[model samples]
Target: MLLHRLRAPAVLLALALTALPAVAQTPMEDPLDARDARRVDRMEKVVRELRDIVFKAQRTGAPVVVQPADTDARMAELGARISDLEQSLTRINGSLETTGHELELAKRENEALKVQVKDLTDRLAVAEKAVAPPEPPEPPAEEPARAATPQEAFTAARQLMLSGDYAAAEQAFAAYVQDYPEGPRIAEARYWWGKTLTVRNAHAQAATAYIGAIRGWPQTSWAPDAVVELARSLVALKKPTDACQALAELPKRYPKAPTTVTNRAAATRTQAKCAA
Candidate 1:
């Protein structure tokens, strides 16, 4: 009976030892806890004491000693693996942070480059406008057909002047003077040209045309009128003395002038404040 009790205790202790190795070899999802480790150490110490008691009861002179459970070695290996995992996670996190910072910097640089490109484009446009050539002026419109003869040209020019087409009349009369320098109506054309110039407030040019028309005091019907116009132009030019001089010659040069010419000469002299 005594041997049986001792054997029963030994068998129970052996079963506990076998079960402990199986539990230690089992894979765990989580790290070992301090409390669970302490409990396992107590269990191993109890199993060792029980084994020693069983051997003593069998009359063995030597005390049996057990090596430490594999659980401690496995726990140490699990701790190292957890530490490695933490380090890897830290490295991964650092890499992600660095990449994110680089991305932000790149984005900022890209935006700045975009702004610079736009500025350059704007400047290029302005430079192109500055250097670009101006558009050519439009061509002059077609003019009226030329008159067949000097008489026809002079008549056309006179008709233009009477019709209030002063721009056309000025061009026509100028053409008449060029085409017929010695034409019969040259003096009359010149006088009408001066009238057009005076209408446009071109007193300086009108004076020149009037002087040309009355050269040598021709006895034509327009001569006295031309002389009066010359004096009027000189008055407009602020040359009162020259105006008076022109008016003084109207009577001496053209004694047969009409009453209208005499009246105009008197008025011009008064305007010039001429010496009586």
Candidate 2:
């Protein structure tokens, strides 16, 4: 309202000035003519009167009157400008608030993504460990235990012989004979033991193993094989006569031997040399 009051007179003055003509052709006149002198005097008196009135008004603190519409219009324009500026401020604040919220949400999402990545990485490591093959444990430097009983040892020795582990089988059978001279499979063990020795080219040892099988268990199932092996071993030992005699007796003693005829003929040939 105070701004309106200040602007009203200025607006009225502007309108009055616009209504007046800015340019005019003046009547020619002498500089010091009586008619011009009278006109100049009249103008000077009018200006003096107006100056006096303005001076008096300044002295007095009287309120200046102005056109109501012009005053009100200028006030309305100012109010509108102020309103526009306030609305612009409100829009800027709202935008700032929205941007802040979006930034906060982005931060939270980033933190959650980091946690998910860490969890996935941890699970991946565990899975790799679970699936990766393990290295085999080193074998003990020493050999394992032997069979306890003589029969057990002999049986083990026979299995080893079948598997062609001749050296191990021979050791097993020797241990058996030393531990239990009268074990049930002694003759069988000795027979195979002798064959194992022959396979290893231990001729003397083979003869000894076969002789032990024949003398200790003459009635055993292994007796025929043992006797034949004994005769062959004796032949290798350069005792052909003893070998032939043993081979000749093999069939009579054990007629069920698998190669009775062949053994008898070979023994007969050797016995002929012995007789000569």
Candidate 3:
């Protein structure tokens, strides 16, 4: 009978030890509670003393002293605490999930706002360009005056040449030539026009002008000089044979020509590399 009593207490202790791991695995809201820890320590000490008593009775044929454990109420309270802790943890996890979802929605809204801002900016630029104004039209040009007579035109052209306005002189002389092909001073005008062309380095045009000036060998005061100028223009044109021929005719055509004219002709022959 005594053995039966001891074995009953041993079986109860074994069941209690097996239940401990399941209780320990339960979540706690506050595992560091001093009151709860002290209650657990008292229960463990009672179980250890009971185990030692049972072992001594079995070994020495003595009566076992088993202490009644006061742990049932405390274990029930701990279970309630663990249940509350699990509910609290569930609430906290749900709150965190809700916050993450709100952040995701906020990010999507922010991105949409950025796209809207860019679209609005482009629309504003187009609107500004559409509302801007057009430019004004240009004015008409003035016409140059006409000279009343051919002499007046010719005198104006000669004055332009004398004033060193070569560009205006060239245009004026060209206009005079067109206006008065049969003018009294046409040959002299051609000669002066040739002088302007030579200043402009238009040697070929100058040669043509000089030829026209001395046509039929007019024997005018400027005629001998015009022949010398013609030979000079031919030499500049790289026609040495034509230049020498023009120079050869100078003495026979204008024998009483000025010393200046004769001297220029002699120099022109040397420039042309003329023989004897």
Candidate 4:
């Protein structure tokens, strides 16, 4: 720094030396000339003080620039390199930021894809259920089967009668008659079938069935019972005369009827007001 300050004094001294020849060529110097010489002396004294300042400043550790032009060129080159490095760092930072943004976008897209896949899976499950065939219903539990024998069928029908299920008993006896005409209890089935119909206030149908039982199976034990019930059914049809006629024919049709059957016919004939 002090060496640069010394340059101004050196330039002034060179200018002063160059002007000394012109000064010597002039006439006896005027007051202006003496003033010029005094001014030159003051400039020389200032130049000397600048040299002493330069020496003192150098000892005080002030850096002196020896070659200003070369130092300026080197500093310019260093500044340019630093600026280039800063620009490169800026570009690198920008590139890094761009990459980070791209990665984030990809991550978001991946997450969205996963969500879509999950939703599709759920919908597929629901769709499968919607289109799937319904399960078949379970079969009902089977009841214990009844015996299919003639005696069993007749007994079942008689049980209905004992239980006071006249309609069911009539249906049962009719089914028995259809399935087994030569059943062991066929005669009883026909007779009881008529009795069931009569109990249900079906006198006209009962009369037809009773007559069929007596004529169809006259040799059977239930034939005489059919004849007795037939007369009773006729009385129920509001035909006392027809009932009396049926009772009178019973002795001729079934002479071998049991005492109980004969007694029952007599009681029915009395109730029906038959001619003595």
Candidate 5:
């Protein structure tokens, strides 16, 4: 009986083990339900990790990683980026257009200024040519005067002496004496003019002129001419001895003058001849 109880227990343990396998073998509609539940738990864990990463990024001021769930959401994000790019491009294009327009206006103004400067330069050249002054005419050339001859000058001097223009006549006679002291007419002119000056009471000047003619024209034909006149002037000056000496030298200087020899020999015969 004890043995039968023991066998009954063993049989019951085997039957329980056997019934568990049979239940496990039976088919069910939710075959992977537990696996699905585990998969859902793993997905929940990944979501929690992503949330933590996003929180950390926020704290550090960094960008969050996000995934779009649908095409509409992705398309909307792309459209926003495209709109921002278009706005930037529009501003850049507007600035470029404004700069180009300003450059074009400057070019036009510069060209207009160039044309105006050229016109002003041309007008200035024309005005300078039109208002220019004419040159002055040159002056005519002149000829020099001729010099006078000696004979003409001598004739004019004799005429002045005869006219009693004593001062002018003295200058002319002095010039003639300087120019032609040995000429034929010089002794006669000097002797007669000295006598005329003595008669005019110019005794000293008359004596000087007579002495010059006697000393300078000693070899000329007027030697005895000046000698006789000088003797007369010395007598008038109360120089009788000097007058006698001058009278003695006349025949020696002009030996061929018979009149001079006769007059001198007669004058030397008596001291009263000086007074005569």
Candidate 6:
């Protein structure tokens, strides 16, 4: 509206300033001529007035320019620009929101993929273990040299018997005898073998072991004990007469035996009622 008010005056000022220059350009006249003196004076006064107007306009700012007959159109054009800018901003915001949703979905998918990959890796490890061959059970670790001497071997077998590991004791005693046929401990081994058989109620086998012990090592420390075990096994086999004969032989066979052995033999003889 201020532009409207200033436009007409600025146009009038510019027109007057330009027209004065042409009006002052009348055919060249003598400075001393009185006939055109008033015309020259009027022209000079008008020129001076126009010059003053130009100076005043220049002293102020440049004129606010407005095209003619385009007020409504210009206002409509500005309104359209503002509406377009608003629509562009709305579209940009909508696009940003959509992008945010897409990014969140991508993150969730990535996490799911990571979980799947981890599960697959774990399953693959287990599968590899299952399909792969066993480690050969570590080769049994070499099992250090068992017994350095015959005595050691015999003692080991006897310890098994004392500990009531009868099965292992039997195997161990048999192994001892086979490994050391002429060892000093062989007689003791045979005696213990007989005792072990009797305890297992294998009276027939016990009798064989006792007889073998007596025949193979009759002068050894275990002979008296072997005879006692033989009698017991024969009694268990329902041969009480054979058992009594075995007991009767113990005193004469092991005459130098300990008093305890001698007493046990005498008692066993009384139990069996052997002929004197």
Question: Relative to the unseen true structure, what is the C-alpha lDDT of residue 125 in candidate 4, on a scale of 0 to 100?
Answer: 100
Residue runs of model 4 more than 4 Å from their true location after superposition: 1-149, 181-184
| Model with the higher lDDT, candidate 1 or 6 | 1
CA lDDT scores, all candidates in order:
0.85, 0.71, 0.81, 0.79, 0.66, 0.76
Steric clash count of candidate 4: 0
Better of 4 and 5 by lDDT: 4
Higher-lDDT candidate among 4 and 6?
A: 4
Tens digits of per-residue lDDT for model 2 on 1-276? 222223335445544433332311244454567986688676665545444444444556354443245668899899999999999999999999999999999999999999999999999999999999998975533322477777677777778778877777777777777777888877777788788789868889999888878874477666876776777777777888887777767668877776764565466446446443
Best lDDT goes to which candidate? 1
* Clashing residue pairs, backbone N/CA/C < 3 A, model 5: none
lDDT for model 3 comes to: 0.81
Candidate 5 error regions (>4 Å): 1-147, 160-171, 178-189, 258-276
Better of 5 and 6 by lDDT: 6
Q: Between 2 and 6, whose lDDT is larger?
A: 6
Clashes of 2: 0
Residue-by-residue lDDT tens digits, candidate 6, 9-119? 665776667776676766565554775778778777766765565556556745543334466779989999999999999999999999999999999999999999999
Alpha-carbon error at 80 in model 2, in Å? 99
TM-score of 5: 0.36
Cα lDDT tens digits, model 5, 1-276, are 011112234445545544554565467677668887688566655555554554454466454455545677889899999999999999999999999999999999999999999999999999999988867754422211221755665676667668876555565665666677776667655665675577667767787888866765467665666677677667767777887887777667777766754575566435436534
Give the per-residue lDDT of model 3 (tens digit) for 1-276.
123345446656666765665676588887758887888787766656655665665567555544344586688789999999999999999999999999999999999999999999999999989987865643322222446787887788788888887767767777777788998888888888888888978999999999999899997899999999999999999999999998888888899999998999999999999999
Cand. 4 TM to true fold: 0.42
Which model, 1 or 3, shows the larger TM-score?
1
Clashing pairs in 4: none
Backbone clashes, each candidate: 0, 0, 0, 0, 0, 0
Ten-residue region with minimum lDDT total, candidate 3: 137-146
